[model samples]
Target chain A: MKCQDVRIELLAYLNDELSSEDKVTIENHLSTCGFCAKEIVQLQKTERILKSGLESWAEVGEKVNLTEWLQEESRKLSNKEKKKEFTKGFAETKMLKHKWQKVIRFAAVALVLVMLMASYWPQLVKASTQMPWIGPLIKQLVLRDAGLSWAYEHGYMDGSLATVEQDGVKLTVLGVIADPTQTAVIYLVDGIEEDFSVYISKINGDGAASWTSPATKTSVGTIGIAQTYPLPEGEHTLTVILVEEDRDAGRRNERLSLELVTDRENISKLSISYDLDQEVTFDDISVKAKRVVYTPTQIMVEYTVIGGTGVGGAIPQEYASYLLTESGEKLYRVRSYGSHIADGVRELYEVFERPADVSNLKMVIPVQGKHQEINIEFSEPTTIGILDTDIRFAGWVHEGNMIEIEMHYEKYGRVKSITGWSVVDEGGNTEELTIWKGESFGAYENPGDFAWVTTKYELEETDRPVKLIATQVLTIVEGNWEIILPAIN
Target chain B: MTESEFMERLRPLEAYLYRMALAIVGKDDAQDVLQEALLSAFVARKQLRDPQYFRPWIKKIVARQCGKQLRNRGTVFPMGRGEEYVFDSTDKGKRPEDHLIWQVVNQLPEIYSQVVILRYLGDMSQKEIAEALGIPEGTVKSRLHKGIGKLREMLEAEKGGLANEMSGR
Candidate 1:
């Protein structure tokens, strides 16, 4: 067999899936060909490594008591089945009676409403005229229940109307609500003959902030966009600019710009602070929960990791930290970010959605007590094409279709930032790749060090040349922002 | 079959099911997945046509249950950041290398990971894996080959990294 043919069947041969003749032919090739022989050896080593690494039942089953657990589980299943059967029968009978009762009640209510409306039409109109908001109030209630209203229902302070009309397209900003965290604007669009995309380009605010364009499009010409920012206490002006890109025209129109000021009184007072200062030692590391700020939306825990490894070294494994309630329910960490606070100490902030009525909350840190570390050597860096002066491919680590390439850069060079990259196939098809920030192996410590980017693509049977394309490589620019949070009491 | 009959049939596969669950979702979620699979198997007992296919059928249910859990958690194939290999430190019988293999298998894409777990950990034949995954035997064979190739690459990469660390790089 040829080398390519032999390589393809190497796994099948090792698996003993090959026919007798094919097996013998591969054996003969292996006996003569050193490269194929080495390939077979590596394949065998991988199988052995995989089989030896898997946790067999015999190794860990003794502690589990599977038979007893199964018995208990079966009992629970039987009881649950019984309860379900009973509930199903009861619900059917109850539903029949409830259905008739609901129908009768709905009919009576409809008849009464018809009679009342016929007699009270003039009175209702007079009342609605006196209370000008009554018509919009009912519409608002209907919209709120349908999940269409966001500003007034969500305690957003109101703003004035701003309208912009251009080229038969009319855009109106109905109202707005602003707070420290987000500024929500409700807008209406009319005379849109074609589909268009709307986005907020700028939010000139006092504090550092960014705008996330609304993903949901408006089919009924009404939409809202919430721009998130750290708005300090007191009034702050948000210069909101809305841009509409018409799909058919292929042109973007700057619709309107409005300065929205936040109402200090309407801002949420639902924030509470707690100074934990609780420290727990796990193995070689000391984890301290310094403080916790609880808002209605999220709970932020600021903690520090002391004494273990330095930055870019062995950090804690991905742990699911959460707030344990008195009822033993866990609200898991939704998102987290960390930075080096001092020598041997790293400050990590974890945020979790605030659980309703959660009292006596205990912050559970992820401490594996003991960790088994498996150290593996990565392949040497392969020299790919260089992008600028010093930025180039350091090497690549891959498994199956997933490949992570390391791009090395000289410290303090002209290339200040590498934002994104892509893998282009021989067909010139480009797939954007993400930076591999895997804990142990892929993370880059310093800007001058190599950055690991990963992409997954199908490997064709025929050899196809591929190139890595780096995008948004910024030079001689500093990308930094500061957010100063007030001290929580 | 009745619930009792299903329970009796599943009893022998409990240990296998537990290990597969642990391998897929890690220790924190393994028990829940196993219980969910068992309950689902019991609930759908009437759908079982052949008693002979009980083992593979139940194993398929368990695999699907793990997939559902992974989906609900919003994680697809390939381990996310900080989700590296974590061994049960309390299991003195487990070596670091064994945990490493479990981690590697868990990190495999769901399609390949399911097949690998079923074949090796479940002691399932290729035909059994094909039946469990509702895929053709040829597809299972190809996935197994590709999965093994990926496994070899990952192992080699690790070996290279270990050598670099040992060499004081």
Candidate 2:
């Protein structure tokens, strides 16, 4: 067999799809020709890349809990069946009523009346609750809107109002509420004709602020804007800006800004902090719980782990902390954030949904042992580009329609963020891909002098070739800001 | 087959059906399609002539449902970004190359893409692919070979480009 014939049937031969005779012919030809042999090797490599890529893609793809989902669907189906049965029963009852109406017409009429009342009961209750006098009471009870009414009910609102009038428009700061998570300001705007816009110009303190909702046109002459921010607990001033633009004129008709000092005294006193120095020891590591903060919404626990033996060592999964109430109910940690290495100690913070009215709580950390470290080695190193920093691609793993490139860095703890990565085909049309996950330096097992990280991207199959490029890399900055929070009783 | 018998047969193939739906409509809509397909298969169970063909029969329903949804929404195929569909494991991560290959497969013609997904991701045999697609065995083989050839060509081009890039550097 010639090289051309061998190449044509190579994929089929590799896939074992060709007949035994054709396969034997290719094999006989490949034995004598080194070029055909090399071609077969390349073909096998390509097949591996494709198959492995698909396999990994399958692994990463979204998984559905089939049993649970099917059970829920089955329940819904059964409910539909029940509804049908109920309708059938109601029809039979109607037939029976028709037969009885000849003997007892008043009793049949009473039964129909009762059924009508039962059907409309929910609507009737809703109508009663929507009465003019009852609306405010219901709103207060439910804390429906995050506005002055809610703040007033939560005891975070102050009666003192600040008013600013400019350009025939009057803006009144109805109340202010401040807490650890957010500081909300409710303001009323008067003299706005039809359409208007409101913005929180600035919160003169640490953290960020934005308008929680658009200025709602509450009534004929009044509109309200509620702005909230995670403001640092201290005395600070807030600026509210109102702008009215005329589209036909293509210009602003009126603009006004008002500044007011936040009523710090009236803010809700909801959170309490305790200094803890508790320690728990396991086989491989020791965990110290340094501080615990309890708030109505969440409980924050700060801890440090030390003496885990290995490169890229992590706290064992079994050591995950949970709260145990006095009644022996366990509450799992809902979220954990801010894991950083400081002074050679792994510092971690976890947040859990606070159990109500639990004065004393036991934080349990069942330490199992150190997790086994898996070392990933890159056999092929591909050098692609030159930037100010030394970042190289070590190797990549393929799974269906996606590839994860192992990124190696020369310097540890320098690269902050990887952004703007995309695969550009030969046609110059770029198909943008995202880095789904990234690990900081020292978080992984680094065998060489440098650290390694892996990032995954979505790929498209094109007839033309493609190259990967990153638009930006943010470097770590060296500084920290501390904000003081007031103690609440 | 009765509805219960159909459901009993389909229960084990739910994962396969899910991946197939995901390939066609994407992760967000895959569940809806799977649900609709199962409900449809249950409702039309009596129409199934042979119980042995339940796998392909259900798969056909899922594919048609997925296509209908895509048309109704006027959405192009492969709508989600790479990050939207991720492996649940923290230990295993995807590479850029894997993503690239996935995209290439997705960008293939609908017929080719369906055959590739069914053969590989759905873990179906050639016969099953043919049955599910209502195509002859020879057509399935032809499409599979052509689809794979196109993929190999693209991959080879990409490798050549990378080599050039390395030399240029």
Candidate 3:
């Protein structure tokens, strides 16, 4: 090896890393070459010195006890485990406490239910006594042609009756009915087959109709008679009379009169058993066209079918129709279905009943004629579906851009789309790229001012002072179109 | 082999491992390097092909650990102003003949100091040093030769050594 090569390996030689052959060669050269030998000596001396120094330092280092430190750490871990056990126990105790509370609350609720049942005890007992077989029976009495009805209930006794004459008219009394003093009064009046004006006067006390009859009018039946009357509670002697007109003499005379003996104590037992649960009434159905306007393309017809459940529970289904003609000739005629069994559309062809679930429909009649006549009839009630209108959007302009808008862009409608579509900051800076129709449509440079252009805006640029607003101009084309934009606050 | 077994085997090589760590890092970071090298050897114990060469293997681990530590730490003091003259056996209590030599060593470029440490502190052969640092042997020689010569010149002015003849002496 050359001297240079030997010097390069000298440190390794001192450290005994060189191969035996190379070491032998280096040692042989060292024997002859003081130059390389001294270099090796100096390098060794440096190592000896550094080794001694480091050895001392290592000796002085504090000895660390790895096992003791690990033991301390393990102790801390066990303490944490103990604390976790205590916390688990506490949580379990709290859960048990909550369970007991729920049980107590349930018991309190049961007790309240028991108390409520006890509070309504008297009502239960009374209801049981009033059930069909237990309480005193109410007797229904039907009087015919006398233009009256009389009934009694709850231990009513026999009543007295008498006849009387006044002004050449004679009236017969049926009797005075009595009640058990608990519910109501029962009056028994004689049945007069013909219509007569009857007046009753209480000679002893106040409960009486003390007046004279105007005339004796004959009746076909007793359907018009009213059973409800105002009578004071007391004992009374009533004189009732039937009056008639003496036509030849032109005089009014009494045909018959009768005395009814009854007391309030006995009459109070009477109970009027009315089957009021059954409601009876009638409905009047009428049809007429209210207003009619005829146009070439459309005939605006407003017709009202008047019908209501009057004095009746419900109105029957009614239908009516109107006919249109040009110069008295047939044009278009439509009517509602006479009576609807199904829920059909409320068109002019279908008819509906009064007191209906859905009532009153306004129809637009398309009249092929200038002059039209309406015909109407009544049928069954009907239900009509309600209708609502929806709007759509077309396009708009903001600033220098053309903004296409739908109902979604309402607030921007009045504003110029050229100004509103392309928003620019006060500094007129927009980081966004202006996309004119898409690239598929061939992108065009915004000549800044054009009939159709698109510009983009950056939201941050407009945040500074001199706040810029987007002025939108919108063009609403066609019908049922609107812009849905926020009102400029 | 387990990490503990690897470290146990390296117990006999503590001096050489520390020296290699010192050669790569400085005094301030040598301990961290030694510990880290031991850990790396433990994790890669299965890959240790030659168990008898464990000392050199540990030395290599120390060198790599030092380098990674330096890179991750970033910015050794600014360099290239002058050469640092270091004496290995100098007592910590005994100040240097020239106190500025340490400042100059810090000022030397990392490239020069790196080779200087490997040569002087590690006592490594140029070829071995080059292999560990992944540089050319010639690069190691050049860096060491120039660094030592510059250090000699810097120290000659304060000490009695001849600037040119110190390596020869």
**Chain A agreement with the truth for model 3, given as TM-score:** 0.19
Candidate 3: residue A186 Cα off by (Å): 99
Q: Taking the tens digit of each residue's C-alpha lDDT, what string does model 3 give over A62-137? A: 2222222223323434475566653324542222111000001225455455334323422222211222211121
* Chain B TM-score, structure 1: 0.57
Clash number for every model?
Answer: 11, 28, 64
List chain A TM-scores, every candidate, in order: 0.39, 0.37, 0.19
Q: Which digits, one per residue and each the tens of the lDDT, describe model 1 over residues A313-341? A: 12222223556766877555544555465
Tens-digit lDDT track of model 3 for B1-169: 5545654665556555554555457653565455545544555678988777776666556665665555445333211111111111211221222223433343357787776555544445677667767777778766765554344333322232121123332
Worst lDDT run of 10 residues, candidate 1 chain B, spans B79-88
lDDT-wise, the better of 1 and 2 is: 2
- For each candidate, give the TM-score of chain B: 0.57, 0.56, 0.54
Give Cα-based local distance difference scores for all models. Answer: 0.51, 0.52, 0.35
Q: Sort every candidate by lDDT, greatest first.
A: 2, 1, 3
Candidate 2, residues A390-445, lDDT tens digits: the string is 55667665544455667766543332334446666667887765332211122323
Per-residue error (Å), model 1, residue A147: 37
Give lDDT: candidate 2, residue A88. 29
Docking class of 3: incorrect
Please tell me which predicted candidate would have the highest TM-score against the true structure.
1
